[model samples]
Target: MNLLKRFAVPVACAITALAMTACSSSKDERRTPTPLTQFKPAINVERIWKADVGKAGRYLFSPIAVGDAVFAAGAGGTVAKIDGKTGKVVWRTRLHTDLTAGVGSDGTLTAVGATRGGVYVLDSNGKLLWKSNVAGEVVSPPLIGNGLVVVRTIDGQISAFGAETGELKWVYHNRAEPLNLRVSAGMTFAADAAVLAGFPGGGLAAINLKTGDDYWQAPVSFPKGVTEMERINDVTGAPALVGAETCAVTFQGRVGCFDANTGRPIWQKPFSSTSGVAQDNSTVVAPDDWSVITAFGADDGRQLWRNDKLKNRSLSVPLLFGPSVVLGDYQGYVHFLSRDDGSFVARVKTDGSAITAAPVLAGDTLVVQTSGGDLFGFRPR
Candidate 1:
C-alpha cells in the first residue's frame, strides 16, 4: 500500500483552503504543515551520489541494497544496478510493464510486481529469468529466501515460487476485511525458514518457507473503534526484527513485540502508527499518525522520549543510521534527530517532492528515493 498517494488528495484540498483562513477575521484557522524552524546544524551531511531513474510519482518501490550493488526499481518498471561507492550504473533493464512494488532480492535473484497481477524475475546481470502470473495485484515486494520467491498480494493471498524455475510451490489464503487501509504488508523471514507476515486485518502468521503450511497465526491488533474507518487496523509497514523479538505497529491500533518463534507477547504498548518500527540496541522508535516520533525501551516497552516538532508533516518511517534517527517528510526534507533524546540534529532539502518510500541505508551512506524520481545518497561529513 502507498499511503502517500492514498492521502494526497485530501491533503491537497486542505492546502488550497489554507489562504482563506489565513486572511479571515474569524477565529477559524486550519492547521497546515509546520514551518521548518531554523537551527544550527549539529551534524554535517553531504550529498555524495545522485541518480535519476524513471518517475516514482505515487508509487512505492523501495531500493534494495545487496553486497556492493544497490538495486533500484522505478514506478515505470526501470530497474538499475548501481555501484554503492561510485553510484555508477552497472546494468539497467526495462520490463516494458508498469510496476506497482518491487526491488526485493536474495543477492543473485531479484523480483518486482506488476500492476496487472504478475511478477517479473531477473538474475544478477539484469537478464529476465521468468515472469509468473498470480491471483491478485501485489502491492508489497516479494521476499526471496530458501530457494523460494514469496509474495503477498493486496487480496490477502500469499504465494511461493521456485526461485530457479518459477514453479509454483504453494499458496495460502486468509479472509480479508471489507474496510482496510490501502497500504501494503511487508514480509520477513523468521529464523531463515519460517515466513512471517502481518496481514491487513491485524493478523500475524508464520508459514513454512518450503511447504507453505501454516505454522502459526495470531492477532496482533484487534478492531476496537465503533466506525469502520476508525476500526481499520492494517499493519502497513515492515516488521522489525532484533534478535528474537519481532515488533510491529498498526495504523489505528497498537504496537507490540512478539517472540519470533512462538508468537508469544513480550510486551504490548498502546501506540498508533502507519509507519513501522525501527530499533537500535536499547530503543525502538516509531512515527505516529500525527508525525510525532516516539522512542520506547526495547526491553520493556517503556516510554523514553517523544518529538512532535514535525507534526502534520506526513513523515516517512524512521531509519536508525549510526548515532542518529533519520526521517523524510512530505516536502522532501530529510531530518536527523538524535537517537538518545529525540532532538533535532540536522536537516537537508531534496527535490521538493514527497518522499513516499522509507530512507534506505547502505553501509555509511544514506539513500532516499523520492516521488519526483530523484535517488540520492548522503553521508555525514
Candidate 2:
C-alpha cells in the first residue's frame, strides 16, 4: 500500500486527539476529562511575555530553544525566531508550505519539516538556506547536531541531511506497524555521538552521527495482545537520557532504562503512555494514556509515586523544573506538581486551548506553546 493509503483510514479516526483510540464506544462511556478544581496557588506563576505565531492546525508543532533564542513554526507556514528573555520577534519568515514539525536548531542552523515530505533549513537571521525533500510526513522537529540534520518521519523512516550543503546523507527505516500513533517521537543526541530515536514497533535505535550506521537497536517494549490496537506497543514519545541511562515509554508496553552506548537493558517496568518521558537528576516522570503522572527512580526504574488527579486530561510531556514537575492539559491549564509527593503546587491558564506539546524549560524560565499558537514564557515568583 502507498503511505497515504496505509495511514489514511486509521489516521482519519485517530487524528482527533493525535493518539486517541478511535474504537467504537458509548457516549456515556467516553472518558470526559475531570473538571479542574479551584485551589489556592502555592507558587506564583507569572507570564513574562506572549506572542502569536500562527494557527497550529492538526500537528503539535513546537518551538526549539537554543541559548538566548527560541525558534517556532506554525502550520500556517509562519516561522519566527523569538528573543528568549523578552519574547520579542527577532526574525519572522513564511515557508509558503504547511509545516508539520519544526524549529530544530543548533543555534547557528534552524530546520523545520513539512507535512508534504520535505525539510526547510534557515539561518539564525531567518534567511532561507536550503530546502530538501524527504520520504514521509515530518511530524517531529528534526534533530540538528554534529553537522547533520536528522529527521524521523511518520512512516517509520529516519533520514539525515548535510547541515551545510543540504545533501542527502543516509536514511534508516524501522519496522513499520500498520496501527501506530500519528505522533512522532522527537529525536535527540545521545552522549554527543549518536542520534537516538524511538519508532512505532517499540524499538529504540541509535545511529552514529559520523557514519549513519546503527550503533544499537534495542526493544524498549513489545507487542502482546490479540487485536492490532491491543498490540499497539508503539514508542510514541521521545526518549529521555540522563547521564548513562536512557529511558523511553511505549503506548501499550513497557518503560525501560538502557545503557547509552550498548543496547543492554538496565531495568524495565510495565507502563503505557503516548507522551514522552522527562527526567531531572533523581526521577523519571511519565504520563500514561489516562494522564496519570508517575515518577520512577532514575537508576533503578522503581516506582516512587503516582498522581491520578489529572486523570483523562490528556496531559503533555512532563517538564522537570525547579522543585516541581509541570504538565499542561486539554483545557489550556498548566499544572505544577510537587516532585516530592505529586501534590499540586501551582496552576495557571493559557488561551483555553489544549497544550498538546510539552513545555520547554530554558534556563530557569518555562516556555509553553499552546495548540492555538499562543507562545508564553513563565517564571516563578
Looking at candidate 2, the ten consecutive residues that score lowest on lDDT are 2-11
Positional deviation of residue 341's Cα in model 1 after best superposition, in angstroms:
0.3
Which 10 successive residues of model 1 have the least lDDT summed?
Answer: 8-17
Q: Which prediction has the highest lDDT against the true structure?
A: 2
Model 2 local distance difference test score: 0.80
Error of 1 at 316 (Å): 1.1
- Model 1's C-alpha root-mean-square deviation from the true structure amounts to 7.2
Model 1 bad stretches (over 4 Å) = 1-31
Give lDDT tens digits, candidate 1, residues 137-166: 787778887888888887668999999899
- Number of backbone collisions per candidate, in order? 2, 0
TM-score of 1: 0.90
| Model 2 Cα lDDT, one tens digit per residue, 167-206 | 9988887876777777757876764477778888799887
- Listed in order, each prediction's TM-score against the native is 0.90, 0.93
